[model samples]
Target: MTGQDTLETGESVRYISASDLRGFVAALFEEAGLPKEDARTVADNLVCANLRGNDTHGVFRAPTYLERVRNGLYAATPRINVEETAFAARSVDGDNGMGAVVGTRAMQEAISVAGQCGTSLVSIRNSNHYGMAAYYVLQALEHDMVAIAFTNSSPAFPPWGGRKPFFGTSPLAVAVPAGKEQPYVLDMAMSVLARGNVYVAAQAGTSIPPGLALDKDGRPTTDPKALIDGGTMLPFGGVKGAALSMLMDIFGGVLSGAAFAGRVGNPHMDFDRPQNVGHLFMCFRPDLFMPMEVFKSRMDDLVATVKRQPRAEGIDEILIPGEREDRSRRRREKEGIPLSTDVCEKLDAEAAKAGLAQLNTTPAPFAGK
Candidate 1:
């Protein structure tokens, strides 16, 4: 997919086609023992993130995934199992598998069940980082259904009013299909910033915005490295975000019978054991609640009404949550994905370490920057 606008002056970057990036990533995963199809699925989900401006959750994570595979902390050939199944619910055991694989299977199962039962929910355990939650919810949208997803991660934030880290930057995502408008998708972390954003900032040798996190001693700081040095992320809001993060911890971790609070391992560290991350997926067919035709028309009307709102000074137009991402996806699909020089270097190094063919391109440097 094509990237956004060109880089600013003095900004060094390279552009890679989404298809090529996907092939290289899939090859690395395949070399690490994942089935070809599973590798491709994972690659597609990651690359799609880059195409949609979520570089924090995209191929920048390849090195970490490779390291986990090499350490045997992440199972490349996992034996996924369905622990329990009911009319509209299920429990899945990921067997320490990649989050993309486990989440895809669980969401697919939920979609199938929802098709027959009108709604479904699936809980997954023993999964690794699932990349972006949007990837899974979008899957349901493709089937003309509404989807909701939640996942817990390594400890990065503290409980409300506490300094010790006990909660993750848990994420929640929801998506709904539309008739004449882009699907409505909302994907976000409960922390002031996603932990991945701090990693990205560190990679770029940049400081995070003030108030996002604290230093090792619990003093507020902007240094991205603080996140790696036992610092804690601030909640997005004073107490509300912490409440949501805690709720997700209960639903995704405790409810799924997986590791929660500080017990969950970080995928990039603590290689002695798997992350044992947890996820929850829910799907519903709109037709079950209203006629399909009426639902589509109403969604269109709702979108138009929201967009028609008056704009403030300096504002061009009001856009919905997923509109910008949808535009980015379509543009990148025709152009190409942009990767900063540092990210490209990391990916190249990963390819060499994996004994796979490195990207064979003489990237055209961004002009002027």
Candidate 2:
């Protein structure tokens, strides 16, 4: 087929390769003052996000992130320090660094420690937006480790039964490596939708789905603008989702001595102070309970069994966790990733402002599979 699909909101978009997007993003960040290595890290993460079809957490956020770094809010280069350390756990201070950078460092520490200790947990504070939680999960997957990642973000939704926003849309992710099947990767936000999707909608001049968000007055709304302007997002599964959000705040923010209870600065709005976002990363060898080959075989069997189960009416097939995204990534790698016209224009304008080259794009129209 074509590129499987493109543009979540049916907006006009142009397709480009992953390498080109990564280069442009890295160059943009470097021009904005981040170190080359750090910029490349962030670029790779963003491009991976886009390849997985999560444009909300993808390069769509570059402008906002770049602006925050250019302003005094985010440190261009901060000292990532371990505030406390133990054999199997550690607490870190990001020193107001970019969230993705801090998260990458923290997750790397977790993987390194877990390699020797069998398991490791790393908590970090004073960070900014860390993008997709699954990015860290993929890092662990590279090492054949089971991984769990959590992060608390800006206040976007209310607690259960409350009208006013009081909780952050904390995101959670888990990954388990497999031999033949696609690895198990589950990444979800506590809110009905991540606020980044709302930002993306606003960029595309489209409205959000009804029941996904509310205006400031607690009335149901589809207007992304209204949702961002003091509006509130609904929890994914009502109280259950709210309860999980609380856990993320505990593990990522409160337990890490970072901002909690809706105190994390909004990356889109709060410029007076640092986001001080928090993250938790846990990883362990999959063979802790058995041989490595046995674990892999078990995972493959589980996936095969699940895929053999009967499907509902009109269903074509059963997809395990992360399978759809993995499929999207494969298609995008060959056909190219799609960037919305709106986002492209904004990025090009930003690049011109920074005296940098605009996105080097290949013209490929959206042709749904």
Candidate 3:
């Protein structure tokens, strides 16, 4: 089933089943030269973003991914290697593989080491764009472990007070499990919002909200196109966010022996060069200091306690981070994912270029009320 949302501005959004979208994306990836397993892995990560309502990181990225593959910037089949293995830490070289594939392997190692040592950290370098950070951390929830993930990307933002672009969005995500409650997941970019969101807006011909971006001269602007034209993104909370972004750049990039600060290449801008992005994933058993059940109970209690707090003016209820996304995922699973017409058109065009059949352009409305 599917649903349609008509904007006041007369834009009509069509909802496509997640399974359908995933299959189509996988087919496209295969046609672009990825192994069938790798194709499915990439498809699953992108569809997960769509299910969580983060369309900026979803199937819309297929074209650029294929372009990189064709340009020899992204390796369709990579030989990822593990180096400097320790009791509780390790480093990985991605061999320029797709981030989803590299990240899944790295996170699996973290989970394995954490199972034996109570904690583990894995650093990865030379990977291409990894989909939503939450996808990796959420893997730890199944093992009753807490997870934290971070990644650095090509420079698209400046230092706190400086005007020159110096760091990528540098995203971070954390996840913890709770008994009888949805796991808490917090995923966010250090920037005000992901740079991909600006690209999405540009494709949809929508205006970005004021203050989210600056023109090439560092002057605030609402034009999404400006971001594509060498503009900079504003950090989420100015100095604080900028500082956190810098930290991610240092640990996730520089310390990992990947590209850092301005040295990183952007798949969009520095297409001729490799991105050499870096990621960090850490996981630990929540029961390291307490019983697993005890930790889960306390987490549930904390969520309930926060929900019972006095409501603020005009606010319905306080929500835990990732709650909205969980809700969105459930709703989308039943009603299908809403995609802008512009996005479908782009996908259709990409499929044609890849010698694959076009995806269904019309969304199927949900059968239920």
Q: What tens-digit string does per-residue lDDT give for candidate 2 at 1-369?
A: 123235658776778888888999999999988999999989988989999988888998898899998896888888999744787998989999988889999999999999999999999999989888899999999999999998888888888898877788888899999999889999988987887888888877888889888899989999999988888999999999989988889998998989999899999998888999999899999788999999999999999999999999999999998999999899889878888877788889888988988877655733442
TM-score of each: 0.95, 0.96, 0.95
Highest-lDDT candidate: 2
Cα displacement (angstroms), candidate 3, residue 45, comes to: 0.5
Scored by CA lDDT, what does every candidate get? Answer: 0.85, 0.88, 0.86
Please give the ranking of all candidate structures by TM-score, highest first, separated by commas: 2, 3, 1
Off by more than 4 A, model 3: 1-4, 7-10
Q: What's the lDDT for candidate 1?
A: 0.85
Clashing pairs in 1: 1-332, 1-333, 2-332, 2-336, 10-369
Runs with alpha carbons beyond 4 Å of true place in candidate 2: 1-6, 365-369
Error of 1 at 333 (Å): 1.8
Q: Over 4 Å off in model 1, which ranges?
A: 1-11, 360-369
State the lDDT of candidate 3 residue by residue for 98-151, as single tens digits.
999999989999999999999998999998789889999988888889999989
